[model samples]
Target: MASSLLKTYKKFKWLPFGNWLFSKAICKRAPYFATIKPKVTHLSSGRICAEMPNRRAVHNHIGTVHAIAQCNLAELCAGVVTDATVPNHTHRWIPKGMTVQYLKKADSDLKAQAQIPLPREWKDKEDLIVPVEVFNSDGVKVFHADITMYITEKS
Candidate 1:
């Protein structure tokens, strides 16, 4: 099992599937991150770019990645931003709606990015549109999902 994991790790450094390594552990076995996984490839307060592979389980009958999978990535992309924007104890965030556009077929791995640049006029009750960019392994834009998250008082 360890050898196989080493093989997979060698094959894809982005394994340990679903959610950022700093967030949580999803899969605990070989190809450990074969499940839903996210790796923060780049990050900033206003922007964050992550990567997650298009595994077989996420593919539909057409052998392409499922739209839901893309949605999940979009959500995750926004979610990570909350960690920095809201902080661990001060605020909480949840998905309000998803406006997604499937621009092309995803035949390879994928990268999901969410840019949360705080607007100058951002009111206390402002809703945020986390612009998530999804790219295929070839670095082609495959999908785009704007996930809105409403932040409010936590009780």
Candidate 2:
């Protein structure tokens, strides 16, 4: 389950091409995520961090990073953190909803951080809110997301 996955990630993340390979696998599950070219910078039980470059592929007409692209990064961070934190044998998590705010123009590479409390128990169904913050290269907050993840026991 997630514990084993986390262990695997920890073992390989330090390898030369580990992070890139992990991102590639993630993109296979969610193809649009590949468009942003996300790179996971950190991961742990309750936290995750990732970055996306300010490339032409992610640019908006105004030359800033597109809003949806930021959202995608936020979701990616939140989902990874949730997957690592939630116990995998009994529960699985899926993004159910999100509320986002664009605080400033993101004209540079973006970094996203997501955090959630480690769940102590799982119900038949529950909604857990994971908060993610995105920062521009200058360390200014550019976007924020409160993503609601639906958790359920495996049938």
Candidate 3:
């Protein structure tokens, strides 16, 4: 019981907010996402995850997370992961484009998780697709996006 509690405590000790705070303080030159504030919900291994609730105005007249907002969410997740994964001196990452499928209208809080291919390697400059799944508060997959990111490597 103590071990379980300690594990859980340790997990929460370094909250996602702490990680985000550290990221924000240390990495300030993040392009496109510099001014956008996204609450980081999870980050483990090379995966970065986030969640945002759709307010009344953040949606379209149909009331949803909005297509553009969904794209933003995808970008934020992929950007954070790339920021955390790639070495600054040797690599730079920029989002190229996103192919998204709106499975349903997200009326509640939405969860977005970003992940790259396992055992990521930076052999050469390449374009990569980082897949993110967005789930609604009811745990339904309301959206899925494959974001293309252009990565440049320093020789």
Candidate 4:
């Protein structure tokens, strides 16, 4: 059975600008993510892609995308992809911790992709690591994050 988020995506993914609207709806639910103004470009069972514009709002004092903004984009992709892939109603997940590396200065708009292998079977509890990579407009990998999610059966 598909998660509600996945079902919703399937329902609207073919519509014009549906992906953009879906991203906006997610930002509305998690208002803090609106800070980065993320645009989710692709979403599927085990992979997700998103973009963060390089605007003054997300710029650092050095005139590049702030480190935290990239982190935000990573978390957004990880969380949403996990939510969309995991079995819904029976399980819940939350961020346990994050380990990140700033490979290079992010000077332009950034794109992020998160990926993980689908579990063969859901367990009672598990710590899932979702890896996310962020690239600049020129396609240079500028940031990376391994977000740990604590998932448990909803009793």
User: Which number leads on lDDT?
Assistant: 4
Ten-residue stretch with the least lDDT total in model 4: 116-125
TM-score (all chains, Cα) for each model: 0.71, 0.92, 0.76, 0.96
Per-residue CA lDDT of candidate 1, range 81-142, in tens?
Answer: 65445532434566688899999988788987787767433334547788888999887999
Query: Which candidate should be chosen as best, given TM-score against the real structure?
Result: 4
Off by over 4 Å in 2: none
Superposed by TM-score, candidate 2 places the C-alpha of residue 27 at a distance from the truth, in angstroms, of: 1.3
Off by over 4 Å in 3: 1-37
Judged by lDDT against the true structure, how good is candidate 3?
0.70
lDDT values for all models: 0.65, 0.89, 0.70, 0.90
Q: Per-residue lDDT tens digits of candidate 4, residues 6-105?
A: 7887777788998888888899999999999988888888889998899999898999999899899999999999998778878899999999999999
Model 4 misses residue 97 by how many Å? Answer: 0.4
Question: Which residue pairs clash within candidate 2?
Answer: none
Candidate 2 vs candidate 3, TM-score winner: 2
